[model samples]
Target: MSTLKILFVLYPGVTHLDFTGPHQVLSRAPGSETIVASLGGQDIEAEGLTFTNLADLSKVDRCDVICIPGGFGTTAAMLDEAFMAQVRRLGADAKYVTSVCTGSLILAAAGFLKGKRAACHWAWRSLLEPFGAIVGEERVVRDGNTITGGGVTAGIDFGFVMLEELAGRDYAEAVQLGLEYAPDPPFHSGRPELARPEILAQVKARMASATDSRSEAALEASRRTEPA
Candidate 1:
């Protein structure tokens, strides 16, 4: 059997769980190989950890799957025309293009989400429609070749879903068992809908600030693309 090559796109300040969680599940699949690709062959920092000498995006020629993770950096990445072009090119060549959290924002900026049903973090779900996507609030949303997940931890579920679609249900089940996929949140406040009203309000306020900043960045990027 041919090995399935999976490419992971990363950037500075990416959320650790967004990529790592999915990687933990996908890497365990039989005949699967994973590679970390970045804008350049330089080290990037994420959640206080440094990943060194990852594959340069410019050099990636092929991949069975492409996974894009989200974090604060995604706001900047969505604004980078060169980066979006690269993503568009690579994503076109890959069999499956997937993202977690606000990473879908980058894919949208690349013009890859056109007419696709996609999911993103609850904090930024409204933004996807501007890029021509039908927004889905589900933890894992699949629209044709595009798969998106909500928030950080959703990557795990997204991975299993993709695994089932790509490999098989049995393969996905075995990997889930290997990871001991059981959730036991210490509190019932993990989801925004289930959280206390005061807590939800606070979280929304913080997310609003981030959203404003992301909007500004996207606008700036759009301005840069305008004919001079």
Candidate 2:
């Protein structure tokens, strides 16, 4: 088989972990090349970290896999016509369409996830309704060629899942072993369901502004597109 190209669609304000978690794993895939691109090949600042010298989104022509990582900038990225245009075009031809965190929203906005069982950050999962996405609560959800991961850390899981699909279980496990992919969190507060009620409340309160704005943006983007 020819070498597989896995391309990451990046934008400003991306959660650093969301992109790197998967990149770190997928980059290890045998016979695969991973690339990162952004608008005009400009630098991107994600959570204060800067990524430079990226491929220009418009200039990227093809990929076997395309991934969009989610972040605080997701709402703006969804609304950007040029960015979504690139997403739609690449996704149309890719063998696997995927996202991590709110990145699924970008896929939804591009009309790639309609009637598709996908995953996204739990806090914003409901936003998928506007784009006709069927929410999957699992850490990693795969519906045909579209695979999505929930929240931030799920990207690592997403990487391995897709890596196994492209390669095989043994190879994936081997990579996992090489990377020591074991998880033993000291805190049990990762998800809202697992967190104490007060803690969840505090997070929700802090996120209210972005959540509300993102909700409106999703509705608007969905309205602009014809349902698939």
Candidate 3:
């Protein structure tokens, strides 16, 4: 079997689990290779965790699959014209393109989500429309060659789904069983509707801050021609 080369785009402040969770699973697939790509040549810090540099974005030609993770860094990445252009270019050559959480926003910014259904962290779902995507509420959404996951943890489910698509249902099920994929949250507050009023309020406040920051970055990106 030919090896599947996978490229993961990472930046400062990225959510480690968003990429790592999926990478661990996908890399376990038979004949799969994974590389972490960054803007320049330097280590990246993710929520106080540092990841060694793997490759520069400029050196990548094509990948079998590409994954982008989300966090505060995604807000800046979405606004970076050069980054967006590179995403667009790479996506065109990739067999599959995936995003977790608000990383969908980066794909949207790159014009990859147009007229496609995609999933993103619920807090940022509304913004998907601006990029011409049909925002889906599912934990994982597959639209043609684009696969998106909701929130950070949903990347796990997304990986399994992609595995089933790439490998086989039986293979995916075996992996899931090996990983003990059964879930049973002690609390029923996983969704917004199940959250307490106070908790909901706090979440809303945090989202408001993120929205403001993204809006500012979007404005700046509109004014600038390319990323620095």
The model with the greatest TM-score is: 2
Q: Candidate 1, which segments miss by more than 4 Å at Cα?
A: 219-228
lDDT of 2 by residue, 58-115 (tens): 9988999999999989999999998889999999999999999999999999999999
* Candidate 3 to native Cα RMSD, angstroms: 2.8
> Per-residue lDDT tens digits of candidate 1, residues 79-172?
7767787788888888999999989988877777878999888878877776667899899999888999999999999999988987899989
Ranked by TM-score, the better of candidates 1 and 3 is: 1
- Write down the worst ten-residue block by lDDT for model 2: 219-228
Deviation in angstroms for 158 in model 1? 0.5
Query: Which is the better candidate, 1 or 3, if ranked by lDDT?
Result: 1
What number of backbone clashes does candidate 2 have, counting pairs of residues 3 or more apart or in separate chains? 0
lDDT of 2 at 82: 89
Collision count of model 3 = 0
Tell me the lDDT of candidate 1.
0.85
The collision pairs in model 2 are none
Against the hidden reference, what TM-scores do the models get?
0.93, 0.98, 0.92
Q: State the C-alpha lDDT per candidate.
A: 0.85, 0.93, 0.83
